[model samples]
Target: MTVIGFLKKTVAVPVALAMTLGMAQADTIRIALAETPSDEMAAFFVALERAKANGLDYEWTAFSDEELAIQAVLSGQMDIGFGTPYAAMQKSKAPLRIIFQLSKLKFFPVTSKKYETLADLDGEPILLHSRGGGTDSIANVIEEKVGMKFGERSYVPGSSNRVVALVAGQAEATILDLSNTNKIMEQHPDMFNVLEMFEVEASDEALFANLDWIQANEEDVQIFVDALYTTWRDMNADPTIISKETNPDGPIGQLPPEILGSLDDFYTAAVKGGLYDPEGGGMKAAQADMEWYSEAGQLEGDPASLNIDDFWYMAPLEAAKAK
Candidate 1:
């Protein structure tokens, strides 16, 4: 071949390569979280760090609540989100897919010393996270199991808020997760008592993404999922990693000095309380959630017939498990 022709071909090849690289660099994956920083998002933050190390570019947005997070994923405003709203699945018009289950928020009924059990709260007002959130669902199950009913109640919107309500004598009882429950009990040792710890099999947080986005960015999606599963494994393997990585000026760090200092203890207590899995894999938890939510009337179809395989893609998780 002529030298001139060869040079031209070499230059053309480099230009094409540059264009490809530019396109890949320009692509950004957006993830939505329900809050700025919380135990529910620990794995995700760790995963984001890992993903950056793996050459993946992502942006994160925090919504006020799970409903909004799900809406963001469904509307294509975000590529992925944390939280599982079974009701949204049965009710939303958008096509949202549950890519992975994060973890379960084990709830306990916390009450002042005056009350002891579910039945004790009959005709008494209680505080809940919201009208139709995880806490409300647990309340419903508790009522069913105890064959009683909750009386007049108010929505406090957050675990910390509910804890304050209970301590201030604003409400008789409230259901809360291990983290917040631990914080309250530790901060004021004598103010509250756990009435009972109720094990509700459900996914507190799940990786959700737009179906169309996944189909279009299959490779990126797979990589993101793989990093997330690996992060979960690593976080669970060493719970201290969360406290270490926590930014002193970041969300969790911005808590009052007292709360910030006790973060590590809170995480330790959470691990022991079964708030997280040592292995961090979610297949078993997902299956259990499928059954539990179905039984709780949150899911529209029977758990056995729900085609569990359709809800989650196990390839990434399986790969992480193998590692």
Candidate 2:
């Protein structure tokens, strides 16, 4: 071969290999998650572990709160996020869509032994997770039901932090979800009591993505969603599956030894407390959440008018159901 032709062929081969490598690199997806270990994120974590085994490259970003996670997904910093802040979704400039409904958070009004019911919280101080999170929204509903307003409420960013505040008598009452509530009740059964607040079902944690990103990576998106629903089915069928699959080196595995060891029991109690769905499809609870939030003026639009089809893409869930 002529020298010029040989050089041309070598350059073309290297360019082609570079393009292939770039395409492979572009296929990677990043998922963001809130810090809490509720059932809402169980399926995603399971799918992530499975995806690693299947040669799917991905990474995760965990935020201290749901709002931050939602903001990260909205800002395009993450391709997918676990929590769908519905109020933020309605107001964001960039279009976002819910691809999967993970689970509903059944928040309970927990208080010191001095309070027996929501009515007793007429002038009591409350510690909330944050100003406008799931816990705060639930508190709004309780105030309406009991015809009392929360006094001297404070925002403690982490649920564990809020629990600490309650334990140390920094706050007399607070609304907490099942996971933290379980931990608190177990550790100090005599110190606190959970005031049943008629079950506020307004907020659901969902899997969401930017619309443009989903369109750009449809196949990978489909695969990720498929893995998610399959994992959901497996988790709902047997909640212990995730606890069993918890990698000693993975994020869940790296939790404090005490938290890691009690995860199975925690899972069992959460499910029993109606924090998780054994069937994995909690559309009814999701619908109820929409209504409750709308009633609380947290969401501007009509819940009934909001199209369920627009909110969630059921294709992956349907595929998992068929399997």
Candidate 3:
């Protein structure tokens, strides 16, 4: 899957920030991030700090979007990336496979007061994060379940920006993550409605890499996954653990005091919302993703017929659980 050839000309070499961690080892793992660092990444950074303490050296570059991050890994420019690159994997038939499930499809369909329920918004224009991103896939499943198709689809990059668009009357219907959804509703409860959405347990964000790379870097990969497993378990048990463990000198900690201050509130809400799976979402998540993505038109063939191992390498996660 030479996705590099096309992207190499367009995708700029992502500027690596001063986010490197651990002792400078001979082999530093290159990580491709889908978005700029923010509150949502605090837990991940905490896990990285844990892995760093265990001698897992690494550096990360923030890509403009998830596609670029996936391409960076697929092209061998980076060893691993953050995203749910199901479409890319299916299209390129690359040996790219997900190792850890970062978060589930916990998005909410928010709309103006003109719509009270999902059915009322039939044939309405909808704003989404990207053409083939998590929001678009959620919209696909919504249409399938609600028995109605949207009128027009528009693309907007960020959930906060989409909420702004809704507030400014640019678009009435859109999907948003838990944090943004809660913010908009709390701020202006009278102006909008969070329509009832069907339950979705599919992987929304995940850590994926090429299988060959995983095999060659098994040690570092195991350390990273083990840290993630432990951090996720601790976060589920006590959501405030993320804020307490955040390094004041790190990227997440460098954000504005407002965001840093609310880390506890955000993570507490996220945990109660069932955003992260304590077990790292190995086989169960792989199976749910097959069904969800297939229904959303990201993958071909029957979901039951698809091989889970083709999209997920579960050994590291299995070892994490064993220990």
Candidate 4:
């Protein structure tokens, strides 16, 4: 997929300041991420820089995983979180509302030369990310769709860790994100092969916030949303903007030089894969997310029964796109 091709086809903030709400603190919007810092989030940080330029005060913290991130947001320790804990939010009746769909699930099940197909791994052990992560969710769907189930499950949070484990003979099979998959195949041309998997119209990340906070900070939220949408459009139009805004002292630059070499290739694949949504503010993406999660058994009952109003708040996103 050419970068320009995606650009040709696709057409696609902050308030938390000076508030005397129930919690007493500074005005920055407290944001939380489900995972530690990595290159995937570089462009988001660039958007935050843009938001700062617009005088939106914000700060973010990273949780060990999405589960914790959701908890933080529900407890109001953070104003917003970067993950989709749909089931948990529904069960708890948490006032969380998804404001942005960050990225689609563009994962691949990859393994060493020993396994050539998904059916070949019926009794083999597989290494994956956390139980509810993107790779893990894809594996769940693969099992149902292909009528095959692996033998054992091992959890290793990062794709790079799983890749290292596969190479070190600690595991025979694992699921990886696109960039990691590319890096593995590039390094050991004959060692690993990606198993064919069906496309999952699922979201890997989203921006969600407590309903009350969003209502109170509408204008600021719109500013942040608009900044993020602009970031996606800008980055898609020129992949080099990612590298341009990458702070040398920041997370992306701190990655090993070898991983940095694959940065351009990674974004190239992302654009081709349609990982970033062109219009992220509507029910279209949310509907797909619901269906995918329901199919994966991550949510209970029929997806059609899940009301969009319960899970999403699209006004800010819609307003952002209008700008």
Best by lDDT: 3
The pairs that clash in candidate 1 are none
What TM-score does candidate 4 reach?
0.88
Candidate 4 lDDT for residue 110: 90
* Candidate 4 structure quality by residue, lDDT tens digits, 1-323: 11111111110011122121225244567777766567677777777777777877765665666776777788877788887777776787668899998887888889888888899988788887776766667777888888988788888867788889988988879998877888789888888889888876678889999888999998789888988899888878877677777667655677788666666767777877788876773688789888888877778888999888888999998888777
Worst 10-residue lDDT window for candidate 4 reads: 4-13
lDDT at position 293, candidate 2: 71
Candidates in descending TM-score order: 3, 4, 2, 1
List runs of model 3 lying over 4 Å from the truth.
Answer: 1-26
Model 1 segments more than 4 A misplaced: 1-26, 247-257, 278-281
The TM-score measured for candidate 1 stands at 0.81
Candidate No. with top TM-score: 3
lDDT of 1 by residue, 1-323 (tens): 11111110111122112222212122677666665465545445666666656767665555566666666676665677777766676677665667776667588888888887778988777787655566777777777778788898677656877787877777868888788877788787787878865566577667877566677887777777777776665666676777677655434555577765666676667666666654443567767877777666677787878766556656556655686
**TM-score of model 2 vs. true structure:** 0.82
Q: What RMSD value applies to candidate 4? A: 8.0
Q: Give TM per candidate.
A: 0.81, 0.82, 0.90, 0.88
| True lDDT of residue 17, candidate 1 | 26
Where does candidate 2 stray beyond 4 Å?
A: 1-25, 36-43, 201-203, 278-286
Superposing all C-alpha atoms, what RMSD in Å does each candidate have to the true structure?
10.7, 9.7, 5.7, 8.0
How much is the lDDT of residue 164 in candidate 3?
Answer: 92
